[model samples]
Target: MHSVIETPMYLRAAKAAGMNDAEMKAVVDHLSMAPDDGALMEGTGGARKLRAAGRGKGKSGGYRIVTYYCGKDVPVFLLDIYSKGDKTNLTKAERSTLREILAEVANAWRESARRKAQELRRNDHD
Candidate 1:
C-alpha cells in the first residue's frame, strides 16, 4: 500500500465537511490500498475524484475527495475535499491551479527523497 499525505487544506475541508476520524481513516485506508481508485480528472495534473461516504450518508450524498498520485514512489496526496451538495465539479480556473500545485508537489517530493538518499549515503561513508 502507498503512503497517504493529507494536506492542511484537505484536513480543513474534511473537518468542514463534518468527516470524523473514522470517516477520514476509511478514506485514507482505501486510498493507500488503491491509489488509483477514482476516476481521472482532466486538466488537473493527474488529480482524481473519489467519492467518499459520509457518516450515515450514502455515496450519492457524500463527499468528493481530490487526490494526486503521481506514481508508486510518491505518496498519495489528499489535496482537497468538499461535500457533493456544495460543489459537483471544479471550475476551469480551479483545475489550472490544481495542475500547477500538483507539479510543485511532485517536484518537491522528488527533491526531498533525493536529498534523504544522499544523506544516507554520506552517513554510511563516514
Candidate 2:
C-alpha cells in the first residue's frame, strides 16, 4: 500500500464537509491500495479527482477528493476534499493555482530527499 499524507487543508475541508473518522479512513484505505484510482485532472500537475462515498450517501451524492501521486516512491498527498453538493468543479483560476502549489510540493519533496541522501553519505564516511 502506498503511503498517504493528508494535508492540513484537506483535514479542514473534510471536517467542514461533515466527514467522520470512518469515512476519512475509508478514503485513505482505498487510495493506499489504488493510488491511481481516480480520473486524472488536467492541468493540475498529476492531481486526480476521486469520488468517495459519504456517510449515508452513495457515490453519486458523495464527496470529491483531490489527490497528488507522482509515482510509487512519493507518498500520495491528499490536497483537498469537498462535498459534491458544494461545488461541481474547480474554476480555471483555481486549477492554475493548484498547479503552482503542486509544483512547489514536488520540488520540496525532491529537495528533502536530496538533503537526506547527502546526510547519509556523510555518515557513511565517518
lDDT of 2 by residue, 47-116 (tens): 8999998878998899999999888778899999999999978888888999998888877887898899
For candidate 1, the lDDT comes to 0.94
Q: Roughly what TM-score does model 1 have, to 2 decimal places?
A: 0.96
Candidate 2: 10-residue stretch with minimal lDDT = 102-111
Q: What is the alpha-carbon RMSD of candidate 2 to the true structure? A: 1.4
Tell me the lDDT of model 2 at 96: 91
Return the clash pairs for model 1, or none: none
TM-score of every model versus the real structure: 0.96, 0.92
Steric clashes per prediction: 0, 0
In model 2, pairs of residues that clash are: none
The C-alpha RMSD in Å for every predicted model, in order, reads: 0.9, 1.4
Residue 16 in model 2: shift from native, Å? 0.3
Q: How well does candidate 2 score on lDDT at residue 1? A: 93
